[model samples]
Target: MSKRKKHNLQWIKETLELKEDHNWKSQPGTRIFVAGRGALRFDVPQDWHFEPDTKSFRFLDKKPPNDDCRLEASFNLLPPGEWADFPLVHLLKQVVRDDERNPIEQGEIIRLKRQTARIVWTQFKFIDPQENREAYSRICIGLGSGVQCLITFDYWVDDAERLTPVWDTVMESLVLGLYIRDPRTGLAFPD
Candidate 1:
């Protein structure tokens, strides 16, 4: 058999080379955190595993490939000079519609808008195919300046007593950055 070469795409190369400390990072605290890219300033439970990605990240509360206990966050940022053309609610609805499975129970959209940011979210219950058990999830989308962040938290219903607090902590502290840039130096800031 002949050996095949690995094809490295532009995005794959760029994403692979992104160092943790230089790009995204989590500062020490009671909960794990994702802080960078002007996308999020959010945290998860203290014991969860932190996994990184170019435009998204995941926090696993349990071992992978099975069971339902994890949180995922994805984001998009507009170019410095541009502003969002679609309303926040529009994006929020799309997220709900795009869920992998039809939910058994769905809560109303909870929305909060302020000068700093506007956030919309809801919780849903469904049967997770991989785990073959009832799963609870919350999807939150926030927009501010030219950045938008979407956070999804999924857990087993039986574990709500333990996981609910983790979800609350995340929503309470979620902060979307303005993504502003300094004229002299193009680096982002705030810890």
Candidate 2:
């Protein structure tokens, strides 16, 4: 018959370790979790994969027989006085306005529910360098399709640092997973 399915326990274990090492904090009233060290965080039913050499973490959601999503947050440690010189708010705006890449509208929020979560779409932008340029906009699509919600979280970078690039990559990755063409083909793990 069929071979045993390989479980991603290793990835899960590593993610826990990383979370502990960073003393990650969970946002109040939200399923999202964040590690301030590298501004690392991901949605629920998701896990993390760490690459020590690269000092990066990949947040992956592997729900079998349905959908999957991956968001990677990498750390590029800068010297005491050298950091990505870019405004985080500006980058957020760019991501949201890039409608061609992401279907986010300005000042629009949609509430959605999936089989896994009840998400709220709230626009946010913060100018914390340690956190770098951070922004999000779009529907809080989760749980099932019936309760899918839409929200906008557009933001941009105020500085001219390379952090925006990293943010862009992570955002694209997450969006792609959320809007997969076929759920059957979107499974990140086996049943």
Candidate 3:
């Protein structure tokens, strides 16, 4: 068999094995991300597909290579302190500062407070050079209950019509589920 890359785009689907992993478990419109001390819950449209990776949990509205319309969530298990201890804007500012991309726009910070739980939120739209197109992303950092959960979503301009509602659903539905215990072990996690 020839080792040539298909059409120079660098993928030969039918001739490739294509995986180290591909796993997902879904019910309706929700998915749970569990960490050592806590868990995060968010809305992932039931119609979308899930991709497994070692670094983070990835969900997409379409298949790979077409995965520009996607969401990425990272569970930060090692936060320095509890949410109430830090000045909200300061923490959020650090997050926005760490990004290397030049964002074209920024939105107001949304602080989601549930009793004592707090999740700081904001979004930015920028052009992703790797994607070679203008893309928008919503970033929310849930800072409370001794944990930090970051969720970022990116979608190309062309797919906004189909992807916007999915974004709204996620934004409204994302919540930090703190210390929900498992039935058997009784550790912190969702059932």
**Best-to-worst ranking by TM-score:** 1, 3, 2
TM-score for each candidate, following the candidate numbering: 0.70, 0.28, 0.68
Ranking 2 against 3 by TM-score, winner: 3
For model 1, state the Cα shift of residue 146 in Å.
1.7
- Predicted candidate 2 versus true structure: per-residue lDDT over 1-191, tens digit per residue: 00124444443233322322342333332234333221223433224322221333333333322212223333222234421233333444554565443332245443333233333333434333434533332322222212222222223433214233333333332221123222223222211
lDDT by residue (tens digit), candidate 3, 1-191: 00112232332223224233423333466554443434566667766676545546678766765555768777765555544766766777777777787888887888777644577777777888765677777777776555567777777777778787776676666656456453234344333
The collision pairs in model 1 are: none
58 in model 3: Cα distance from truth in Å? 0.9
State which candidate has the highest TM-score.
Answer: 1
Leading candidate by lDDT: 1
Once fitted onto the true fold, the runs of candidate 2 whose alpha carbons sit more than 4 angstroms away are 1-56, 63-65, 82-86, 102-104, 107-191
Misplaced by over 4 Å in model 1 are: 1-29, 65-68, 80-85, 178-191
Name the lDDT value of residue 29 in candidate 1. 53
